[model samples]
Target: MGSFQIEGGHRLSGSIQPQGAKNEALQILCAVLLTSEKITINNIPDILDVNKLIRLLTNLGVKVEKTGKGSYTFKSDDLDLDYLHSEQFKIDGSGLRGSIMIVGPLLARFGKGYIPRPGGDKIGRRRLDTHFEGFIKLGAKFRYNKEDRFYGVEAPKDGLKGSYMLLEEASVTGTANIIMAAVLAKGTTTIYNAACEPYLQQLCQMLNSMGAKIGGVGSNLLTIEGVEELKGCEHRILPDMVEIGSWIGLAAMTRSEVTIKNVNWNMLGVIPNTFRKLGITIEQQGDDIHIPAHTNGYEVQSFIDGSIMNISDAPWPGFTPDLLSIMLVVATQARGSVLIHQKMFESRLFFVDKLIDMGAKIILCDPHRATVIGHDFKSTLKATTMSSPDIRAGISLLIAALSAKGTSVIHNIEQIDRGYENIDERLKAIGAKIERIA
Candidate 1:
């Protein structure tokens, strides 16, 4: 396992560009299997998870070519359907959670799709029932091999027939998977209570451009009319909003002046304003976000009734759960206390013990919530060695280390690399003292 050696108490300046959206890239990559024509994708982040999915596609006989840095052209003219049942595929497909998405496209275009139980962050129980359930609603037969922990879905002899589905929960990945499958069904498919995140909207728009008929691009109700076949088109991914939020928190925690370029401001939803609630200054410079140096510590805002401030995650138009770890870390040095409620995942707040060891005052009320008492920068966190548990927690720990007193070592940094692209180099460009130790 590789580690990161970080020298703390350094202020970072200059500008950093967020990489292509990791979540969107996963969905878009899977959509390439929906068509056999040449599909060119730009702004593909060179991260471990995305790369793993690309390799999985390559092994399945999709022709992939590198056109430029962060750009690739893929053609699914030929595919090895038997590879889906191979032992090698079982091992490769189980490496990342994104591999589950490929099943939808394969079942839609071809007749069958199979996948091993996917593996990802150990944050909590991430069920695959939503994806499989959606596939079943689209007239596909589902089966599970408990002994092998594998899932298989096959379309009917007449192929997939569109139907209306009201999801029990608004899941982003589940919605994307069902949308891909429905695009090639026999009739109209209506999905209610769907996730309307910008990335999902991008997926729908890309499908529309590729000859699919989709309505309600940015709403909870999506209507997809089945097309005989889909053609290929060029698509560019948006900047990762989660990474942009992380940079915002990093700037405030270390008292640095950093500018995040080409952030696609309108699509950021409540991210910028949510940071503002923590008393951080976020300036919009055209399409970029400029966070000036917080020479004095920031203060948390209270409710209109003078109650303590509380930040929680919800569906779209609400604060994202991905950045809650960053918010918890940033609140350590703020001027007042704020409550962080992580509603989606249970184990995400377990990393607070490491921060508490670093001299931050945080009360882990339970698996779902924590109250962070800010030191207001009067006390600096003392550096310590730690291990990264997941992607978001890893970056949060790295931010904490960068703002601490001495040097710190983070083991199992592969968790971080799975998401961020060249994170150490990118931080170095903004004057952050981080080194990757192999």
Candidate 2:
């Protein structure tokens, strides 16, 4: 396993640009399968997960060309449908969670789609029931192969018929999958309780640009009118808000002055203000976020009634669950304590043990909650070795290491690579003392 050897307690400065939204890229790339013409996508992150999906598409006979850095052209005019059932496909499709999204477009246009149980971060139980159930509501037949642990959805020979569905949960990927499938159905498809995150909204807008009739682009309820076929369109992904949050936390933890450039501020709902709740200074300068050095150290804000702060994740327009790990780590250095409730994923909070070992005060209340008591910078964390449990946790630990005294080693960095693009190099550019050890 690769590791990051970091010399801690150093302040970082200068500007860094956030990569394209990884979540949006995954869904948008899958949409390329809905059309037979050339689709050019720009600002695609050079991350492991996105690259894996691109290769998977190539394997399925989509003609792909690299136009420039972080830009690619894809044409799925002809695809090898048989490859979907091949053993090699099982191996390829099972490597990343994003692979599950391809099934929707394939089933929409080609009548059948199959995928091996997809693999990704072992955070919690991310059920596929939402995606398949939505498909079933649209008149697709669902089946599972017990022996191979494979899933298949096939539309009738007449094609899928649009229907209304109320999702059990507002799952981003699940919502995107259902929308992709519904875009090609015979009638209007209505989805309630759908995820309305910026990435999902981007997917809906992209589909609309491709001749799909979609309404309520940024709301929980979505309406899609089925079309015969989609035409190719050019799309540019927005900057990743998760990475922007990470950089903000990293700046606060290391007491650095860092500017995150071209953040598309209007799209970052609740993220900037959420960090402000922890008493971090976030300045909106043009389209960038400028976090000044917290030389005097930041403090946590109490509730209106003087109660200890409580931070939790919810659907869109709420603080994202993905950044809870970063918030938990940032809270460790604040003046007051906060309760982090990770309701979406059970095991995500389990990583607190690693932070606790690094000399930060934290209480793992249960699988879903953690109470973190800040050190107020009166006591700095001691460097130690730790293993990354997941993507967000990995970056959180890296931030902790950068603020801790002495040197620290973080193993299993591949988890971080699956999400962040060239994290070590990016840190180095901002004067961070980090090295990649292969």
**CA lDDT, candidate 1, residue 187:** 97
Tens digit of per-residue lDDT, candidate 1, span 1-438: 999999999999999999999999999999999999999999999999999999999999999999999999999999999899899999999999999999989999997899999999989987778888899999899999999999999999999999999998899999999999999999999999999999999999999999999999899999999999999999999999999999999999999999999999999999999999999999999999999999998999999999889999998977889999999999999999999999998899999999999999999999999999999999999999999999999999999999998999999999999999999999999998999997
Cα-based TM-score, every candidate: 0.99, 0.99
Encode model 2's per-residue lDDT on 155-259: one tens digit a residue.
998999999889999999999999999999999999999999999999998999999999988999999999999999999999999999999999999999999
Q: Candidate 1: which stretches are off by over 4 Å?
A: none
> Using alpha carbons, what is the TM-score of model 1?
0.99
lDDT of each: 0.96, 0.95
